[model samples]
Target chain A: MTVIALDVGGTSMKAALVPAPAEPGAGGEDVLASESWPTDRTDPVGGILDFAAHMAARAKALGRPARAAGIAIPGIVDEASGTAVHAANLNWRDVPMLHLAEERLGIPVAVGHDVRTGGLAEAVLGAGRDAGDFVFVAIGTGIAAALILGGGTYPGVSGWSGEVGHIVVRPGGEDCACGNRGCLETYASAASIARRYTALAAVPAGHSTPNGSVNVRAEDVIARAGTDETAARVWSEALDCLADSLAATTLLLDPGLFVLGGGLAQAGPALLEPLEARLAERLLFRPAPPLAVTRLGDRAAVHGAAILASRLL
Target chain B: MTVIALDVGGTSMKAALVPAPAEPGAGGEDVLASESWPTDRTDPVGGILDFAAHMAARAKALGRPARAAGIAIPGIVDEASGTAVHAANLNWRDVPMLHLAEERLGIPVAVGHDVRTGGLAEAVLGAGRDAGDFVFVAIGTGIAAALILGGGTYPGVSGWSGEVGHIVVRPGGEDCACGNRGCLETYASAASIARRYTALAAVPAGHSTPNGSVNVRAEDVIARAGTDETAARVWSEALDCLADSLAATTLLLDPGLFVLGGGLAQAGPALLEPLEARLAERLLFRPAPPLAVTRLGDRAAVHGAAILASRLL
Candidate 1:
């Protein structure tokens, strides 16, 4: 069976014609065709519909016409209604994605939360495959987690289950974009790390590398942590915040494992080792769950979208 | 059909001969016989087994013999194995509760975690019946929560979920019995509130109630909060810690409701009103779930145990 999978993010979209597994509960898949494009910020919904139509056309051209389509989008998604309730980055609110996609592509459509879709891929076929219950935490521009229990993402009361970023690790410490104080994201997100490092470095009290700019990325700050005092402080605080939140998660959920993904997870050992140690330190009783880097990387969401589409079929 | 249900705590036990629901998915139950006793701290397992046997005998005498039994126990429980992994207060370790109960009562047995069991009762037949996904938080000697999703308790990977007391709300604030600093339980648990108030009042600070002793209870501290400055401060800190933990829970789980139970919950409006306000204040973006007192009160666990026994039948 063939399906159209689209992972629509703030800046880019991963569109694919995926040959879904022929048998039930199958593991592997073959991508029939794939492409990427910058998200049309001004006409986001139109862009998504056009992309689905294009993917359907491509699938037909390959003589493997798509049976269903799946689109993984960011924000507060009402999956039951197939509506993108809100996506701050995309300036989207209540876009009837499933209806629009079905109208355009002439196939059953499934819409999923982006992070949760990524987590679905990880839970079924990636790092969390062996971990019975796990949390897939994506640390990109912002932090979010997907609780995968019994091999599926747990959408809490609403679709807002894993808003781990807003968990107050350091109450009344730092101002967050969410209008909260000292959220985990304020210290640990990729954007926050770079922003914090730059702000700290720009201050006159810094001893070395005082020249700060918005161009500085989390990777740069992580790389400079070895000697630069400001970078070290920022990175350390980020690790602490992440540890605090993860510790709370461990206490509440007690998942079998924690799978870290997204831009910051690229640090690999540098991120995992200290995080493991800090989480252990924070937890006085019970062994800490093992931490692992994402196995599927950025392609997770697209694959998960394919899985969602396959489920519809 | 009838079942034997027992809720064994550190200090007390609630035992009952409960009639199994006449129909599946029934709302109410009739207690054929009910009784309570001080827990046999020296021989907790023996006490539990004996209690089950007595309950079974009583059911038989009443011409409604119990076909199954359920025991709700504190501390770590391996429900799958029917073993009480460890109950600190009971000094129990790997006691084969189900096996012992079955041998003693000659019936199928079900073992469950105390807090989770209470949450089950709330989810199916009590306060959380209307709330789809809610966290049942019991703030007695210590704080713990049960995440009820789809009208059942969500047991994490190893059944060690809902250890919310250990969540660090104040990073370096107060020392907890779990050997952690700034845990939510340090400020919010019933025992902690009294302990904190006593400790704060003991020091030679200017206050009306400077004479501190172990005799003071959480209720006394809460009652005095209106007049006593130290009591007010202690109560405020407790509320703050609870609010912080609840905020994190809201972000992580986004439950439909929060069902508060145990000793502290007895404070009623004084606790609920301020807690609701603090939780609202802490959350910047999303709306906080409504907080309600447990309708089953102290009987939630016993009722839940009955539910478990009915499942066995």
Candidate 2:
């Protein structure tokens, strides 16, 4: 069995130990002792209980001693009282966090909601495994979603379902550090497309471009938007506010698929071919739901926190 | 046992018979016989198999004969292939409707989707009985929603889950008849607040108002929005486009309640007290879900088609 996962975020955490899935719903696992680090930005729950006591002493030196532990945090989680009610980049709040990760790893923990345990590990082991209802999104440095439905992870009613980057896709434009305004994470977040292409134009905040990169980041403003015109107008207004928040999540959850995942989906195909042609031209009468990418990349919330600690064993 | 139920609606139809819920899940039923009319809208599937063959001859003259039915309809339904695929106000297409209501009421049917079967009779018998995640909406003459969740009726991955009146809350402003522009049913439907207060007031298309009411409906533009000024600027831009589509459905489905059924929720408290204070001033950070209004009003899709024909027995 073995369990212990972690995740955390606002600047890294990961952890691991995994094992579990020998065939229940079977979304496979394995890890058996992984790690990572960096989160402490002022004690992210004591760097997630010191990385769950170093993955419960690396699952007791591989004798499979980890029984249960999940975690997966990041903003406004409440996964049925496991707490961590607000993260705001880990300034956190209400942190019961499954009773502080079961008093720092005594096991039986569970806690989810890091983009719904990375959309339940991309709805069971990556890119909404043949979709039983989709929408995973992520797009890092702020932007969220998860819905996943039948394959699990709805989370609404107080656990605050998905928060698709604070919805209002430009309704008075800009200003949202969640205090809201044009929020689609204030023009599509990968830190708002490298801060709206470094506040419009002459790059220079460690600028280098022409693909040699330097810092301009949202994958260097999508690899200098093919010969930069202010990085193709801030990556085409961040794919037009992520195609108006996926055309309001395809008219409020018609999800069949839309996986995506963090760190601006590593700008693959410059972010899914202009976000699948601007979410199929803002879904005129509905039909746009095929946008994959994220087959466990960024280890999908530490393999959905080891499938929520193997469903608490 | 008895079942039947119907709904239909492009213009009307209600039907009924009901009974079936003495205990299991207990959301009570008991109708026995009922009716309503007006929707032959160009043979809406032969007026729903002649109103399910006159409600199966009034449930065999009230001796309680109905075995199973359900129906519901309205636009784009596929409810797991009960199929009435498109309704565009009953100019239907791809009809199947539970195989023509089990070949005209010979029994077991079930098709749904009229706003998720009035959000499953407001998540089981009205105003979302104690919320299992809410959001029913309805808002007649166009405007939809319904996504109950845990208590059922999510219908996403296809039956186009809750098209919150085509989301784009004023992204391009006005227009919409689904050709989209600023949807939220082009400024909150109830026929878009009496067609935007009769295209910005002169009101004389049978105008009366001052509560003396006559034609300008939407509850006479909310009883002339307390002394007109173009009915308080089209009912405060239809309560700020239904509070920006319920603050983008409270940040993408944090729904725990928001009931408000059709016919502009009969403008009760002038549409739920300024739409619960403009959905609590456009949810500047959550908490806003309590809206309420539909305690089986407009018979919540004929009692959610008698709880989807008592779950087909």
Candidate 3:
């Protein structure tokens, strides 16, 4: 079956006319046609409607009927209402995403929270395939988790579930964009680690960046962490914060398996080993579950969108 | 139809033969025969066997047959195996509860974790009836929570879902019997509150106990919180710890309502109002869910057991 799957990220959109609804465990989808577009800072809904129409027309040209379209976007989403409740990246609010796409492309549509869509892909086809119940935590510029129960995302009462980044890991530590102090994102998010590293590096060498810009990305800091003391401290603190939140998550949901995705998850052993050790020290009577990295990486979201589109079948 | 139901606690067991498969909103059970007994710390499984037999015999004498039985117990339980897995209070390790009860009573048996059972009752028939997804936190001698999803207990993976009390709230504050330092139970449980109040009151002014035995209870400290600085601090800290833990839970589960039960929940407004306020301040973009004290009280578990028994029909 052919369907359209779009993962609308902060800076770019992963758009594809993908083959889906094949055997569940069958490897990857055949992307009949795919495109990446710089996300419009304005009119996020219009951008999607236009892209979806284009994909459907392209599919028809290839003698494939677009059965349905599935879209994933950043921020709070109410899938039941098919509304993008709020998205900082796209600068949209309550945009009727499903209706807009269906009206434009003349096909059924599915929309969901981005991270949860990613988690769905991971739970069914990627790292969490063995975890009937698991947590897929994505630690990119922000941190959010998808509670995968029976290989599906658990949409909360209003679809605002999996806001793990805002969890107050540190009671009175750093200010977060979410208007809270000590949110997990403030300490452990890729964006936060880079900022922390920049501030720490600034003190010892007095502006490590000759260009007077904070050029320290999380990947850059992670690269230097093994060799530099400041980077090590910054990296360790991020792991501690991540582990603390994961411990709390393990105690509550007890999914028993954790799939790490997003940008920081690329750190691999540097993040996983300490995180596992820290989680083990706190689990008490409960046994520690294994942690695995995402097999689909950034494409997890697109694959999850394909899965959502398949549900229309 | 009638079925046997039992809620086995550390101190006591509430047993009853309740009517089965009635209308959804009906209140209370017929209680064909009900009994309470001191839980035998030694031979915990044996005690349950005896109780189930007695209840079955009583129901038969009343001209009602018990078709099935449901039991809820404190500690980790593998409901699928009917094993009461490792309860600290009972000093129990892998006690085969279901087969033993069924063998003794000649009925099908269903077993579940206690807090989850109570939460099931609350989610379906009590304060949390309005919530499709809710968190029921019971703060008694020790703390535990039940995650009610889609109006039922979400048994995580190996049935260890909702072990919220050991989430490492204080990091390094006090020692816990769970071999961990600063668990949520160590700081905010009714037992912890009473102990902290007694220790704080026993300072400097010395014979601050006046009664000489330091016999202060959580209720007394809560009652005197307004007038006593030490009591106020103790009460405030408990509320803060509970709020912190609840906040973490909200971040993970995003339940629409929080039903607070157990002994400390009896504090009512003094606990709920402050907890709601604290949770509100920390939740940031996420709306603070209403905090509700459990209406079913301690009877929630027994009622839940009845519900579980009814599932057999």
Candidate 4:
């Protein structure tokens, strides 16, 4: 059975015509066709639905005859009611994406939180397949995670579970976009790392880079880690912040594995090694689970959406 | 349709011959008979078995003939294997408690983590009855909690899911008995509250209490909250620590309610009101869940154990 999977990301929406019920350990290679389009943040709701319609039409032209569709979006999603309660980045609130997609695509739509869907992909077919319990943390412009237990997504009663980014790691350190003081995202996120490094470069010190810039991207800081002392300090602190939150999450969930995904995960061992060491040092009796970059990488959400859609078949 | 419920605590063991499947809203009248005995911590394994046998024999002698027995113990238990992996407080390791109890009492045994069982009781019959997702945080000499999701205990892979006490709240604060630094227990537990208050009292003038005791108990400090400035300061700080951890848990789990139990819960609104306020302050977009004291109180574990036993029948 074929199902259409749409991963509605912050800047782009990727659509894939995928086989249903992902084969065990198949890594979602059964895609008949796939495409991508810019996500119109100006009118996020209409743009997403329009994108879904476009994908549906494309699948029809290819004669794939998709039976169902799964749309994975960032933010707080009420899966039970199929509503996107809040997506700060997209500025969406209570948008009935499932109902809208079904109306346009003429197929059942399964809606899920983006991070959770990515986590489902990992839990079912990626690095976390062997883990009965695990946390999937995606560190991009922001940090968020999904808790997979008993082989399924644990959507809290209100569909607001796994909002780990808002957890306060530093009580009064920095003001977060979430209107909170010192959230983990203000420190560990890819965006935060770059922002911190940029600020540090402004300091009048011997460690400051000669060509100081007001703004720097996370990749730039990571690229300069070995040679640039200021960048290294900022990068290490970011890892420390991430480890702190991960340790707290480990203490509560006691999961068997942690699957790291999103943009920062691309840093590979540069991110994982130090994180593992710091986490181990902080943990008491509980053993630290292996930390691995997501095997599916940026497409984990797409794979998860496909899996959810396949369930409709 | 009667079952035996046994709660094996650190200092004492309590047992109750409960009418099978205590109905929601059931009263104390459903508990036909109850007994208690000091627990032998030195030989915890043998002592627990002996206590179970004695309770079963007494219940049988009373003509109840319990259909099943449920035992709740404080430790890391592998419910699937019916083994107590470890209990630092009880000094038990790899104890096949369910099997031993079954052999000694001639009844099938259902074993579980004590705090988790208490959470089950609260989730099904007490303060959290209406909540589909909630946390049962029992702050006593040590801090521990039980996660109730979808109306059941969220026992992690090895039955060690709700070990929130070890979550690093202070990062690099005090050393915990669990061999970790800055654990929540080191700052927020009932024992920690007293310890903090006592440590504060040890300082020279202005900080010293009139009574001048270097070792004040949690109860004593709580009693002095309204009258003594030092006690109030310590109590407020403890509340802040608890609030920080609860906020972290809420962000991660998004539970609908928080059922406070154990010894510190006896403080009632004194604990709930401030905690609620602090949690609200910390949260971003999510609304704070209602925080209520556990209605089952100390008997929550026994009631929960009885419920588990009834499930076997």
TM-scores of all models?
0.95, 0.37, 0.95, 0.94
Residue A97 of model 2, lDDT score: 78
- Model 3, residue B291: distance off in Å is 1.7
Candidate 1: regions farther than 4 A off:
A22-29, A203-214, B22-28, B203-214
The better candidate by DockQ, 1 or 2, is: 1
Residue B220 alpha-carbon offset, candidate 2, angstroms: 21
- Candidate 4 shows a clash count of 0
The DockQ value obtained for model 4 is 0.72
Where is the poorest 10-residue window by lDDT in model 3 chain A?
A203-212
Candidate 2 lDDT by residue in tens digits, A1-313: 7787778764768777767862225536557567788888877787778779887887888777988888788878878778888876677779797986787777788888888888888777776876788888888888888887777888888888788888887778878875767878877788778877876765666767555667677886777688878878888988888888887878877888888888888767778988899888878787898887898778888888788778767
Clashing residue pairs found in predicted model 2:
none
lDDT of 1: 0.88
* Native contacts kept, each candidate: 0.89, 0.85, 0.78, 0.75
lDDT of candidates 1 onward, in order: 0.88, 0.79, 0.83, 0.84
Residue B98 of model 2, lDDT score: 91
Candidate 4's C-alpha runs over 4 A off are A25-27, A203-215, B23-29, B203-215
Candidate 2 on B234-305: residue-level lDDT in tens?
Answer: 888888888888878878878877888888887778788878887787677778888878887887787787
Tens digits of lDDT, candidate 4, B1-313? 7888889963589989988776575452278888888888678778777877777777779888888999998889898768898888777789898899888888788998999999999988889987778999999988889999878898876677788888877767788898877788888788888878777866442344567654567878888999988889989878888999898998888888899999999999888888899888888688888899999889999999998888888
Selected candidate, larger DockQ, 2 vs 4:
4
Best by lDDT: 1
Summarize candidate 3's per-residue lDDT along A175-249 as a digit string, tens digits. 899888888899899989988988877733345574444467888788788888988999888988888888888
DockQ of 2: 0.31
